[model samples]
Target: MVDFGEILTTVGDFGFFQKLIILALAFQNVLFPIFFCSFLFIQSDPERHCNTDWILQADSNLTTDEQLNLTLPREEDGTFSRCQMFVPVEWDIGAIREYGLNETTGCRDGWVYYDTLYDATIVTDFDLVCDRSNLAEVVKTIFMAGLLAGSFIFGPTAESYGRRRTTQLPVVLLLIFITVAGVSPNVYVYMVSQFIVGAALGGYRINSTVLEWIGVTKRSLASCMSQMFSSVGQCVMAGLVYAIRDWRRVQYVLAGWQAFIFLWTPESARWLLGQGRTEEANKLIRRVAAINKKKIPENLLDVTGEQEVQTHSGNLVAHLSKYMSFICVLVILRFSLNLGYFCLILNVGKLGLNIFLVQFLFGITEAPAHFLCVWVLELIGRKKSLISSLLAGSFFCLLTLAFPQGEFHVIRAVVITALVTTGKLFLNWGGSVCMVYIQELFPTSVRQTAVGFGSIAYRGAGLLSPLLNILAVYHWSIPIIVYSSLTLTSGALSFLLPETRRKELPDSTHESNTCNNCI
Candidate 1:
């Protein structure tokens, strides 16, 4: 019986047909970063102060600075208190200014946020500051929960139903959920909508299956290219956030952009072949051949051992039993990467610089990182690539602690930004390498299931990443310490993983277990 790899040889692998499919998927990826990275701006803690405008009633002539000076206490850093104000008195302006009202209380009105980067965000609109500050991070965690929920629901669905149906349905749902999130009347409603958006995103399982359509030699290239486009999406989102500072408007634009992905949702022929739908699989192969301007033998899939096809559809439990050790290591590595990567990305605003430029620089760095990952994965192989990048990321992550805390200086900000950006660059390299590495580790039947396991581990880490910022309350460097520690341990653990460079993707558990070149 001819396997799908042999058929791809006849169908012109990595030719016009595969390139067109990749282009469509790449365009869809460009839209994903709007969701992945939007919160860096959407939920930012902008510069704020208590709305002491009530003091203006007593002193009508007082300028804005004068009003704040009389009404609010100043911190050691010389910034006006964000949540406190002096008790109002009927005394004249001269007497209040002379006495300097000593009684302090929480703002009876609200806050005045002079956010330099954003005119309005969920933080400003909903007053998620001071007491309610932690709520913003809670919302991010809930969204990641939605992603985890979606992965469990849709990852299996893709294995059972076709990839095209599973992918296309979520695009429509994302449009609806994101629209609701844009116009959410309250934070509760917005949280629900964003959770649904995360769920929809989880359901959109496009990346793992992209390799099923291409040949082995092109798998790394396709994986890197898809991630590069996602990086491009981050850059585009940075520009979009700069253009439209309103978080709600950013949501509306992202909602409208979901329509583009609806144009293309191709099924994986290898998946079809594994499902034992020979006729459908043959038609897709012929179509691929036709698009690539190649001719295939008429009886390409005519001879088949039905039992061998059944082996490609084996259940996840059976496959897991055979490869539990490898998969567990992958899950841990994924968790470490997600925790470290997101902790750094979400903290971009606190770098004390132009947030938009910093965000853009972070996104742009990923492009070169992806390219470098492809080179390293091809040259040094997956195991070494992951170890080296993770170690390098850990070093840069530690470098963030060199400067003192609680004070912002231009030189300090520059050094911090450079260190964090360089760390992100290497972490992104590890991420891209991990993705391709996962695809190679599992067989066709259980690939999505294995990816489901990795996603669960990572999304759980993603949920915790935002909350890790709370560690800053204890000490500013605590979160950085945590991120560096996890990445370092993950890098050390990577030695247990085997390399699979330029090897055929395993078709079954037996194939995966018995492969001699997996070393």
Candidate 2:
């Protein structure tokens, strides 16, 4: 039987039809950041101080600044304490300045945020400051836990149900949860809503699975182009937040825009074909050809499209049982790469740039990293590329040690931004190479399973990386040192996998010298 890939070539691999789908699906990638890092904009801990309502009521004649100095306690650096206040007293209101007190207590009445960039946030609304601030991280961790569960659950569900059904269910749930989150009355409600949205992420592929219709040669190009769109979405996210300053409004506006942006997106034709629903797949294919102003020869599709698409239900389990050594290497390497990746991602707020601009620049750097990996893979092949990228990223991270984090703001921002961004660049390439190398290392039947297995370890790193970054409180360089060490070790582990450069895709494990060499 002529495979779907052969049929896709005849219909035009990277034609206008695919472009329309890419355009529609790209918005989904853009919309993801609005939820994923919505915490950054919605829960940001702006400069805050204890609310001095008692003092303000005592005297309206005094200016705001004067009342702040008289009522609030100061730290050693003379900055007003965010979590503490001078004990409320019945001192003579006029001569209160003369009765200066050294003893302080926790913010009894609650805290107030400056609300510079955001009009309101969880920090200001719930008074998640000082002692209560750990709850904010709790909420974020809960959301991540939900994401981890969703990633595991959705892969199997997508195989059982049609891709369209999987997508439709999640998109609807995500919209509802996002709206609920926007209008949530309390932190618990908001976090639960965020968890639901995170769960819906498993169903959203951003059209990566759809590109499987294209042949291998064109599939790589299509994948790269699709990923670039994801980067474009992230690059523009900060501007989106800045323009829509209120977090709730940002959620509402993005939800409404997503409703329209995805209107043109249809179901995946490849998925339909995989389900052995040829009639439906053919209908979609004809519509695609019409949109692209091209024609599929009647005889060509008639001959090939009539075949039933059989799926191997045991493929994943079979691979898992057989490939212990390969799975081990992938899991460890993936965990290390992800640990470094998220360490940088979660700690960006401490990195000294405007959070909005930092997020945008973070997105801007991603697209080129893919191109760089492709270039390096050509130059050095997959194993060496992975090794060099990881080691080199470690070097950049170590360079961050030179700058004293807090004292040299202007200099640290300039120098560390360059170093961290470069480090992320190399780690990102290492990640890309891992994916490419895994596919090459495994036979077709088990490739997806291997990736899924690796992802479990990777997800663990995502959850753990943020907590590891808590070390920043003790010393800013500690997280960087940890990330550097992991990268170095993961790169060393890359030596275990066989080189696949200039080699054809092996059809079976017997033709695979990779596992044998490692053994």
Best model number under TM-score: 1
Instruction: Candidate 2: list runs displaced more than 4 Å.
Output: 41-45, 54-81, 86-105, 115-117, 205-210, 263-316, 319-327, 371-384, 402-406, 435-451, 495-519
Give TM-scores for every candidate, taking all chains together and pairing residue i with residue i.
0.88, 0.81
The alpha-carbon lDDT assigned to residue 291 of candidate 2 equals: 70
lDDT (Cα, tens digit) per residue for candidate 1, span 388-502: 9999999998988888676789989989899999998888788788888888888878777777777777778878888897888889888889888989999988988888898
Model 1 has an lDDT value of 0.80
* Tens-digit lDDT string for candidate 2 (1-519): 555555666676668877766566555766765676567665456788887778766676878888788878778998988778888877767667776766788888877777466877666777777887887777767776666666576645555564456656777787788889888888899889888887776446411334444445443344445456666677777788778777778778867865665645576565565556678888887787777677787765674434435442245565456667777887898888878887887776768777787788878988887766556676677788889888988889888898875564677697888888888878777776776666556644444445556656666677788788888889877888887898889888888888766454333444464554664
Clashing pairs in 1: none
